[model samples]
Target: MKQVILDRIRAALADRPGPVAVPREYRRDLGGTDIVELFAERAADYRATVTRVSTVDIAGAVAGALRDRGARRIVVPAGFPDAWLAGADVEPLRDDPPLSYAALDAADGVVSGCAVAIALTGTIILDAGPAQGRRALTLLPDYHLCVVRTDQIVGSVPEALSRLDPTRPQTWISGPSATSDIELNRVEGVHGPRTLDILIL
Candidate 1:
């Protein structure tokens, strides 16, 4: 009976029209606007703390940010710049032998670099690239401090997607991990870090 019904439906739709061409002229360029400034503004609108600094002040800025957040044990992902951690007044944990989830959860926060950042949507794209670690490293930690260079900021999602490697794992983070209950009660740190700090240099 099922096959008979399927045959009838197929026969009925056999005279359907051909594929239609849809226009996909989406905006890709950010125009003459400042992407870096726009990214900072949009990211801050999501409640993620945004700090702007120069390359020379990265070390000081990083240390200051960590100290401000009272981070004692920071998880330093593989390939993270050592100079950035110079002035940090905290114990850095390197995931050389692989750290357990419990340790990651207990850490003050995780610090790393991002592959690309979307200015329009204020999203941070992580592909486990240099200074970035496994997906779990950012997920388990309560706080995440991501350092993004100005050159890494892209105008739109398409632009950001073009810079990513599909084969490698990717984690897209916007602000902090949060969700609302049926009553509209907000909750943080449910799926990922409760707090997200962005350092733009």
Candidate 2:
């Protein structure tokens, strides 16, 4: 019965005219503005703390950020760069199959690298890439430290989308998890990480 209904719907649509194509006239370039700087500014505007560091000092920066947040039990995804956490004074738990909800909740923080970042919207797209583990690893933790390379920063959303794979599991985060649902009161960490720190290299 389900297949018969679907076949009828498909046959009906097959006889209808196709939809019109919209013109693509939007600007793709960012007028020569520095995307990294724009991304930092937009990210900060979203209440996320952005820290710019040189590639050589990324380890130190990550360490310092984790130290300041007082993170003790850090969750590290599989294939995450070891050098980035070398200076951190904390026990790193590797997420091979991803940790349980209770374990993730108990963790102080999670660290990973994003697939691509959009400057215009100040958004980070995670396709569960190398350092980025399963979605649960990032969603359950209270704090998240994400590393974004300069080259991964794009001028517009279209540019970022072009760099991402549609078939992959993707998480698009504009800022820390938040919701203003109850009584119109704003709240953070309602569903995901409360604190988001981005290390731009």
Candidate 3:
């Protein structure tokens, strides 16, 4: 009986796919090419707007983008970097939970920093860190501006996963929120921000 049980366990294990392997050197060597270009290409493919800008121009670009969206009130996470929105004409709303969904949904936009970006997938992962607030804040808003440092762009999923700590809460956003049903058509802003702008600073 014990032998049969062991054989069953071995069969189950053998049926599963082998663990994926990634080269260690690839992780260290990702910086050789122009990662910003790669990031932009991938983001565009996913239908998100990608902007490359110097630190000096980031604030103005962000403010202008918000204004273009006709957003007068911008929701900011508690730990968002101050410089990104300096002198912006919009009202800055902090990420307090008591901030109603109706009010947040009515706001012009939300701005925050990303934890890490995956180049291959054009994905941004956010841990509920200071600058990144609760998931709802990003989900409920119409427009979202995510600031990503150039150094945070990673070459692949394995490389990005290697850098993340599992203990922390995380949100992975790839393009604007979207879904399609029945006829194979697509719709945006189903569960998260309708417009996603990634500012690589």
lDDT of 2: 0.91
For all predicted structures, in order, the TM-scores are 0.89, 0.91, 0.82
Candidate RMSDs in Å, in order, are 3.1, 2.0, 4.3
What TM-score does candidate 2 get on C-alpha atoms? Answer: 0.91
Question: What ranges in model 1 sit over 4 Å off?
Answer: 1-14, 17-22
Q: Which digits, one per residue and each the tens of the lDDT, describe model 3 over residues 55-103?
A: 8998898887787778878889998878888857888898665688887
TM-score rank, highest first? 2, 1, 3
- Candidate 3 lands at a TM-score of 0.82
Q: What is the lDDT of candidate 1?
A: 0.90
List model 2 lDDT by residue over 1-201, tens digit each. 999999998899997888889899998769889999999999988889999999899999999999999998999998789999989999998875657889999999999999999999899889998989888888888999999999989999889878889999999999888788999997766778899999999
Q: Which is superior by lDDT, 2 or 3?
A: 2
lDDT of 1 by residue, 1-201 (tens): 999999998899899986689786999879998999999999998889999999899999999989988898999999999999998898998898999989998999999999999999899999988899888888888888999999999999989888888999998988887778748987766767888999998
lDDT of each: 0.90, 0.91, 0.84
The lDDT of model 3 is 0.84
Choose 2 or 3, whichever is better by TM-score. Answer: 2
- Candidate 2 deviant stretches above 4 angstroms: 1-16
- Candidate whose TM-score is highest: 2
Q: Poorest 10 consecutive residues of model 3 by lDDT?
A: 22-31
